[model samples]
Every structure is written in C-alpha cells, then in structure tokens.
Target: MALKVLSALDVAKIQLYHFKAIIVAGMGLFTDAYDLFCIPPIIKLIGRIYYDDKSAPTAVVSNLVAIALLGTVIGQLVFGRLGDQIGRRRVYGLSLSIMVLSSIACGFSICRTRNCVLVSLGFFRFLLGVGIGGDYPLSATIMSEFANKKTRGAFIAAVFSMQGFGILASSVVTMVVSTIFDATSDAPEGHTPDEADISWRLILMLGGVPAALTYYWRMMMPETARYTALVEQNVVQAAMDMKKVLDVPMSQIAEDSPLPSSPPPTYPLLSKRFFRRHGRDLFSCAASWFLVDIVFYSSNLFQSQIYHRFIKDHDPNKNGYQLAFRVARFQAILAICSTIPGYWVTVYFIDRIGRVRIQMIGFFFMAMVYFAIGIPYKFYWHNHINDGFLVLYGLTFFFSNFGPNTTTFIVPAELFPARFRSTCHGISGAVGKVGAIIGTVGFIWASKNQKKDEKPNPERMTVALVLLGVVCLVGLSVTYFFTRETMGRSLEDNENEDDD
Candidate 1:
C-alpha cells in the first residue's frame, strides 16, 4: 500500500466528533458573553427603576452586580482544578446544569419583595458567573487540544469569538426588550409599567432557555484525544480516539514507542524555573487584561451615556423626548453590527498573522485613540469647549470592538501549556475581573467626582486613560520580548517540548 501524506489543511479536519467539541467549548463563551454585555443594561434598568433619585445603588444592588464576578473568581480556581482532574467534558457538562438551574431561578426572583429581589438575583448571578468562569478554562483547553497546529489560533479565536456574538446579541436583545417596555411612552416610564410592561421576568426567562438547551448544543463532542494521550497516559485509548478524529486507519497511526504510564507533573508552577522564566510575561498578560478592564469595561458600561448625551444635546426632539428604550435600542444595534465582523476576523486570521502582532498592534493603536479622545476631552472639558465628545466616543467604540479588547480574550489560551492553562487563564481572567469591578463600581465614583461644571475631570478619565496607555505599552513590549508566536502549534507539539 502507498503512504498517503495528507497536507496540513487536511490534517486540520477532524471528524464530526471533534467539530462538536468546538461547539461545546464555544457555548461556555456564549454564557460568559451573556453575563458580561447584558449586565450593563440590566444594571442601568435597575438604576432607572430602583434608584431613580441621585443615589448610589444600595448594598443590595452593588452586591447583586458583584455576585457573578465574585463567583467567577472562585469558579476559575474550582473548575480549573476539576478540568485537569476529571476531564474537560465532564466539568463543562456539570457547569451547564448548574448555570441552567441558576438562570431559571433568576427569572423567578421577579416576585421578590423590595430589596429581597436583589438578594435572589445576586445569588443566582453568582452561580451563573461560576459556570461562566469554569467555561473559560475548559472551553479554551478543549479547543486548544483539538485544533490543528497550523490553525489553532484561528480555531480558538473562532470558538471564543462567539463571545462578541454573545455581547452583540445581548445588546440587540436589550434594545428590543427596552423598546417593548417603552412602547407605551417616551422617556423611561417614570412609574413602573403594568405587570406585562416592566416584566424583567421575561428577559430573565429568555436568557435561561439557552442554559436549559446547552446540552443539545454540545451533543456530539468527545474528550480531547490529545489531552487523554498526552496527560492521561492512556496511549492506546488516546491513540484510538485520535485515529477516529483524524480519520486515519490504525495501521497508519504513529507508534513511536509508547510513552511510559506516568504520574503527573511534580513541580509547582510558581516554583518551577520553566514557569518562573515565563512569569513576567504572564504578569504582563494579567496586568494588560486588568488595564483593558479599566478602559474597555468602563466604556461599555457607559454606552448609554453616549446616546443619552446625544439625544439631549443635539436632537431637535427635546420636544419628542426619546425613550430610554429607544436610545439603548439604537446603540445596541450599532454595537452588534460593529462587533460581529471583528470576531469573524479572529476566526479567519489568528493563526496566519500570530498573536503577539495582533496584541501589539491593537494596544498601540487604541493607546493612540485614547490619546485622541483625551486631547478633545481636554479641550471640551478643561477649556469648557465641547468638541463633539460623542463623535469621538463613537470612534473609541469602533477601536474598542475591533482591537485589544477582543484579543485579550484570545491570547491567554494560546500562550500557556496545558498543565498551567487554567491557572494562567484564571489569573488573567481575575485580572480582567478586577477591571470589571472597577468598571462597575469605579464608574459611580468617577461620575460622582465630576462636579456640575460640565468640565471633564482631568484626574478621573484623562489621567486614568494615560496611565492605562502606559500599561498597554508595557504589555506590548512584554508580548514582543517574551511571548512566542503560537500559530500552527498543537497540544501534542507543545507537550512534546518537555522531552526535548
């Protein structure tokens, strides 16, 4: 029989079983996106409803928002360890059930009395966040393990790119729901609507359906054969699985003398020289992610501010009085349109160009964009000159969706080895969450600090972004210096490096 040497592209095509694994990995990202983009509007809705006055959200409101985030902090550690121990499929499945139940409970909380509703929402949101946090580790691991070396970045990016889809979806959904709530009157109805009108329960209910249906979404995926082969010491079983995925006959499979049945790695990641060598790069990754939170999240949380500010300032319709619903709807539509395309870009090119170049380019330019905004802002606020802040803000959004903001999610998965994949992801995610916490809480502080001068406070935003730019520049350097180009590398390839 003649030997058939499949091209690299041919090597990339796994069986249906492996394709399904990518879907399962992506589902977790969808949940993560749902939690992320939806929360901003939902929190805004709470403000319009509960804290109609100029008051900070109560402890209940604050706690409710933080629950998922805090849950994520814990979930990363918990599921990360579990994924390594049990297998990605099991941990991933377990999380779906937990999330579905929690999301369902969140809907029912609409019946709660007064502040108690916040309590219920908080608890369940925390649970949802946990599942999402778990999703991050497992999804990235499975995708990385299964994808071909040449296109691993694109595959992981494509799978994770659903996050942008999820964000865009949330934006569109919130807009539609807001329109439904506002159909009765312009401007957020000062008074609560009838049971049907203000039914947050409907929104909550809709989000839960996916959680319930997630199992069907991930129906066909098997374990990562590479994980089993490389980490499990079950060479025969792993080989069998790999043969099925690659559509190769058993006789054709490589049998470079079987690896010894082995106990797992012994060195603590922090204690090992190999990891310690990479420590600064990892820290840079974590810190850059943290900085992304400060700007990226804060901008997203305040998306409504742009529209609301626009309508009130330039619109002839001070007479028409646009609904809060209308503002969000338009904004959501625009954001979704902008984000989805960029995600697909990741799907197509992450492997070809390399992750470091993407990160450096995105961060470098966004820094420039932020500086552009700062100059106009300095003129507009510091000089009492409003140089169309809203227009510049739109530009900021353009760059935000297109650049570093999205790449941050893709890089960590590529950079780390499987042994420390989750821990590294957790550390990066936790760093990002710290930024999110600030985006949520710190925004209030920034808003409060701004006096009625219509003056842009130089300290809060301008200086903050400047500092963020410095950090981003530092991240760019670290990426260039320490990070390797991870394009076209597979789990098997990286794993084999230890022996070499």
Candidate 2:
C-alpha cells in the first residue's frame, strides 16, 4: 500500500487558532480543578454548620470526596467512547452543562436533616464530577489533535496547566470569602446560621461560572480534522475544517487527489490488536497517573488537616470561618509559591527535554522529597517545625506537577490512534481517579485511626508519605520501561508506528 500523505493539519504551522483552542480547552480544566479542589474548605464549613462539630465524620467526608470521583470514572468511560463514536465537539458541551447546573445545585443543598443534606449534596457533586471527568479526555484529545508536533507537548501541557490556575483560584476564592465573612460577622460562639454556611455556598457556585462562559465557544468549535479524516473518512470535510483553522486553502489539494472509497476500520479497544500494540502504553499512562494522584489528591485535598497538625497552637477558640481562612491562606501560599510554577516549568521544558525524561525526573525527585519529609516526620512534628514541613511539602507539589502529573495526562492523548484517543485518555483518567479515591478515603481512615492527643501522632502521616514515595519510584520505573517518546513527531507518525 502507498504510504498515506500527511493531512494539512498534521504539518500545519502553529498559529492563532492553536492558541484559541488551547484557551477554550484549557478553560474546561480550569473549571475542573476549581470544582474539585473547592470542595475541601466547603466540607469543613458543612461540618461546622450541620454537625456543630469542627470536623465532619471521616466516613462522611470521604464519601463526599470519593463519590464525585466515582462519577468521574463513569463519565470518563462513557463520554470518552461517545466522543469517539459521535464526535469530539458534539459531546464536549454536555459535560460542562452538567457541571454548571450541578454546581449550582450543590451550592443550594439544603434539607431539614443532616443526612438529607449530605444525600443531596453528594448527588449533585456526583453529577458535577461526571462533567469534570468528561473534560479530561475531551480537552486533552482536542488540544493534542489541534497542536503541531513541534510543540505538541507544550500545547497539551498548557491545557493541563490550567489545573494549577484552578487550584490557585480555589485557594484565593476560599481565602477571600472566608476573610470577608469572618470580618463582617461578630456572632457569638456556637451561633447558628454562621457566615461559613453562606461562604461555602458562594464558593461552590463560583465554580460554575467559568464553565458557563466557555460553553458557547465549545459548541462553536469545528470537529477536529484528524477525527473527521482518520475516523470518519471524510477527507473533504477534514480538509475544509483545516483550511479554516490553519487559514490555508485546501481546495486545490483536494481536487488533485480524489477521496478514498472508504476509511479504514477502527479497532475495538478490547481487541487483541489493541492489546498487542497499546497495552503497555495504556498501562504506563494509567499507572503513572494512578501513582501521581495517590499522593497528589491526598496531599492537596487533605492539606488542611496536615496543616492543622503541623501548627502546634491552632486556637480552638477560633470560629470555623477563621479556621477555614487559615487553611486557605496556607494553601494559597503553597499554590502561588510552588504548584503553579511547577506546571509552567513542565510547559517550558516538556517540548525540549521530552515527556519520558521529565516524567522520570519528576517521579525520582518526588520520591526523594517524600522520603525526606516522611522519614523525619517525628522531628518535624515534635519540634513544631511548621515552616520546614511547609517547604518540603511544597516541593512535592512542585515535582508532582512537573513530573507524572502533567506527563501522564499528555501521553495518553498522544499515544493512541485518533479513533481511540479520547476513549483511552478517559480510561487512563478513570484509573487515576481510582487511585485518587483510594488515597482520599484511605487517608481519612488512616488519619482518623491515629490516636488523638494535644500533639498529633506523626507515625500515621509518616507511613503514608513514605508509601507515596515508594509509589513514585514505581511510577518512575513504569515510565522508563513502557513508554515511548513522541517529541517532534506527527500524530499520524506516532499512530502509524503501532500498525507496523
């Protein structure tokens, strides 16, 4: 058979349309991050309002966090396949709509009984998770398809980096809301209808705005040329879309070469052929992502608990609002100082040094940082070394973003064929969320079981961090052995290699 010629899109020069695609797709990530991370502080506020307990029950909090993740798992699998069958643009907006509506419902969660409230909130958040989950595969695939191979890594990384901004936005919003409410209200201790309840509602609702703003643009986006040509076998339509996107005339080219009689058949994801070609790549992407999230979500979502333990004299007298503010402040500091910068570092270097090397370096350093923090846990805990612990903790966030976290998201989108890219990306993402669920729920159980004292026990936290370090090393190994480099290669080239 004659070698297939590269589509105009495959070798198109980078231009304005690429950046526009990045921003549109990246906004979904921004919304996803904001929606997911914003829940922690709100969970704390819920505890104060409903239970009159400063902290909610471990089981309840874990359910609240993990249920959404479960929704994401389902969404990723379902929507990813749908994206492949229907079209990327067709199903993209549905996820965001779910997010926008569900987020509003979550904010408005109210019932006479605490159980009813939990049930309602969980349901809506689950829906929100579905929306957020769909964004993962859709956005990554869109960015990857639209980007040129010369800067493909950077473009996709740029989309994923929006998560860092979303994290920062969550922290900043939580801090501002908490501070505003705390300042305005001088309610007596144990007051009902406290400011915290209102603040949580506001924060939750705010997550929906970005999603709403980007919905129209998402709808207006033309179907990706690769999907149209490679998947649907619509060379003419694909050529037309590329002409508009790349701003290059393709009429003459299409006239020169008539369209093929039929497109190639797409392989089933579960088929033997897929397993032989992409099984290792899928495992590498999923496993690395799983390891990264095991620590990433645990650390990010539960950082407040860790911070509370670190600070020796956390004043019991402070209202829930004040406490929430402090947590947000500390989280904001870490995000600004470490998390956001780490993402940008990956963006800058991913195209230069390549994905596998960056991922390996990230995992190796992450493992080392976790070891440094975990092994000396007692010293940091006993001596009340808050600043030192904070610095070390920040580094873990840094390397996590710079390493497996960003690379895992990028690789799955690039490695698989256009027909299966979204589905595979979703599968990898869902697997990662499984790890996130394990981490979130497991941390709650582990941390709760630790014997409470005036001084927190370092042993439980110490073990968790060390285990995460071990996971990172395992992730490093997976990346090294199973993954292939895709830098400076067309998407077609990468996919064609599997057929050979």
Candidate 3:
C-alpha cells in the first residue's frame, strides 16, 4: 500500500461512516457546551440557595465560571499531545469517561456546609472542563481526517455545530426543570430554596447523559487512516481501516503486498523547520480563536445578567424559580433564533465560502454589531427599543458561529500535518480557553462590582461591550493578515505532506 495514494480518502464519496463519525465526534462537543454554558442561567439560583443575601459572592461566582476553564486548559495540552504521541482513538474515550464521572459528581455535590458544597462543585466542574477540553482537538482532527476534501470544512464545522445544540439543550433542560419544580411547590410564589437546589443539580448532572450514551460509539471508531499511515508509518493498516470504513475496493491493500517508501520524516514539534513552516499559521489560528472566545464566552456566560441589565429592566420582585425560568426561556429563545442557525449556516457554506473569508466577514460584522449596541445602549434601553437592541445583539452571536468560531476549529485541523494536527489544534484551543477564562472573569467581575454599588449601570456594560468590539477588530486584523484559505484542498496539499 502506497501512502501517497491516500487520496482514496480525500476523494471518497459521502457515506454512512462519515455521518457516523460526525455524530460520535460531535456528541463530545454537545456535552462540552451543555456543561459550560448551563452555568449562567443557574448561577443566580446557586447564589440564592447557597448564600445569606440571595447573592453569590463575586469571588465565588468568578471561580465557579473560570475554574473548569482552567482544567480545560490542562486537558487540552495533555490529551492533545497524547493524541499525537499515542493515537486519537486511545484517549478519546478516556476524556468522555472523565466528563461523565465529573458531571455526576457536580450534581451530587451535597455537603453539610456551604463552603464544602461549593468546593465540591468547583472541583468536579474543573474535572468536567478537562474532559471538554480534550474533545476540541480529538473531534476536529478526527472529522477532518475522515472527510472528503470537497466537504471537509463542512464536516468539521458540523461537528462543532453540535455545540450550538448542546447550548440549546442546556437552556431547554433548565427551563423544563425549573417549570416542574415551580408547579410542584406548595407556595404560591413557587420559588422555594429546596426546589432551586433540586433543579440545578438535575440540570448539571443530565449533561453527562449524552456523553455517557455516546461512549460506546466513540470507542468503536477506528484510528483515522491519516494518523495510522503518516504518523505511524503503517500504510497497510491504514488501507485496511479505510477499506473497512469507506467500503471502497481501491482502498483494500493486499496483506502480502510490499509497503511503499515512507513520506518525508516529520519535523519535531518545536524544531526550527516546523516553526518556519507553520509558526504563522499556528499564531493566526491561536490568536483568532483567542479573540473570539473573549467576546463569545463573556457574552454567553453573562447573557442572563445582560438581558436584565441592558436589554430589559430587572424585576426586583421576581426571584428564585420565577427568575430562573425567565432567564432560561430567554436563553432558549436566543439559541433557537440565532445561535443554532448561525452554526448550521456556516456548516453549509464553509467549504464554499472558505474559512478565511467567512471568518473575516464574521469578525467584521461582529465588531460593527458590538459598536452599534455599546455606543448607544442607553438610547435603546431608555427609549424602550428593546426589540431593536435584541436584533443587533443577536447578530453578534449569528456572526460568531458563521464566522470565526467554526473556522478556528476547522483551520487548525487543516493547516498542520497529520502527525502534529491534534497537538497543534489542542494548543490553539487551549489558548482560546485562556481567552475564555479572561473574558468570563473580567465580565463577571465588572458585573459584580456594579451590583455591589446597588445600582444597575448600563454605562458600565456599554464599556464592556465597547472593549469587546475593539477585541473583535483585532481578531479581524489577525485573520486578514495571517490565516490562509483551506477550501477544496487535501490535508496533504494544505501542509505540503507530499513535498515533506
């Protein structure tokens, strides 16, 4: 079997295995989003149950949001490198296993004291983050490796699109749980602390269910042919796996056939040769992703608060289940109307429009939308133009998915060699998580400080929005200058694997 003829995979027709691969890989991301984004709608509920004044302390809330992100950084770096050194299939199940156990632990984090319970939940969530982090590189690299060149971007983006559904699922689950508790409670207000406690635990724990269900399928998947052939220098095994998965006659290599000469040796990850070839691409992918998460996670994690403070006035009377239900409903609505559609649109057009172009357009509009809202937030809020505000705000999310969010995940997988693909993707993703941590902590701190002053200041939020707008522009600049188009190209072509 000749390694150079690996184009059998690049030219393979769309088939059952490709879709199966997407489902198996995408489910991990689904769990990632559910666990990460679910916190915002329920954070206030946690405060009401755990604290005396029905408000979570600023530090506690910050840690709750950022700690898992810290774990995610560690997981991405560790598991990503392991995927390259060992194999993607070997570590994929381990990450999912960690996610399942940690999610259940977070749900069952009951302790005698508030401090004990908070610590338990925080630790478990950190573990959950590590698992979620591992999924980024493994899923993207796997999907890209399996896909035909013509639709590779769409396939990888489709895997990432699962995050949108995961986010939507989180909202829907929270809404359903809060509604059930509200209906069953004896009090007319139906906002009891006991109900709140039960509702949040159920929401966090159920995130594990999807990942648990997919574990068998994920493990059943074979190592990608690219990794098997190019990385391990085993063309025979690569061809056998390809024939079995794609069911293509040409892919069947004779067991007794002589192996072809190896491709050029892969450079060490930190070697000067590797850096000279891919350093800028790596920086471009990492920087663009870093900038995207700063805006994306900040807006996502605090949208409930943003809804109350900026889009609509907070109803002082509504607390506990009533407030949580409203927040969840809004989150669900936003997910359906903008977030989900944005992702699928990118999935549809990514391979056609190309990753760099869509990313530039996304970042450009995102910056414009941010400025539109931030510069005139007071005008819109005070004038009761909430609908108009919502429209502009929603565009940011729409562009985010349709633009850099999808591209960042896809580009890193394409821009590097098979041997280094997962490791590089993991590094880019981990840097993005660093941006998420900064965004999550910074936005929460600003929002919390405003609350401490006992006045909801729209101006402060406007400042945050303006800062995000600036960051988006910088992302746009990075994309324009550094990222390359990867449409209609084989993985080998993109990274010069043949020349190597």
Candidate 3 local Cα displacement, residue 33, angstroms: 1.0
Clashing pairs in 2: none
Candidate 2 stretches greater than 4 Å from native: 1-6, 189-195, 251-255, 300-305, 309-314, 379-382, 450-456, 497-499
Scored by lDDT, model 3 comes in at 0.82
Best model per lDDT: 3
What TM-score does each of the candidates earn? 0.83, 0.93, 0.93
TM-score rank, highest first? 2, 3, 1
lDDT of 2: 0.80
After superposition, the stretches of candidate 1 with alpha carbons farther than 4 Å from their true spots are: 1-10, 14-19, 52-65, 110-112, 180-190, 196-198, 217-220, 243-246, 254-264, 277-281, 300-304, 311-324, 381-391, 394-402, 450-459, 496-500
Query: What lDDT would candidate 1 get against the real structure?
Result: 0.60
Q: Model 1, range 1-500, lDDT digits (tens) per residue?
A: 10111122226565675556656667677767765656545654554455432212433334565678788767777887787767777677777777777767777775535577677778788888887777777777777776666766777777777776666666666667766556655443344333432445555556656556658655445666655654665656765666655666666454546555566566666766655545765776677677666666566323434533543322333211123344445456555555566566556656767676776776676677667655455445344323354555554555554555666666676676666666677777777777777765655444333444232244565665555556557666766775666665544334434533
* Model 2 agreement with the true structure over 1-500: per-residue lDDT tens digits: 22122355556678998888888898878977887777666766777778775566666767888999999999899999899989999999998899889888988988746888899889998998898899899999998988877888999999999998888888889989887887788687544245566788889899888778888989989898788877887777776776666766655326466755855656677799888888888888888888888888777423644655642114556666766666667667777999889999999999999999999999999999888877787566445556777787789989988988999999999998888899999999999999999988766745654465223346777787788889889988998898899888778864563466
Q: All predictions: root-mean-square deviation over Cα?
A: 4.6, 2.4, 2.5
Q: Model 1 residue 349 lDDT? A: 58
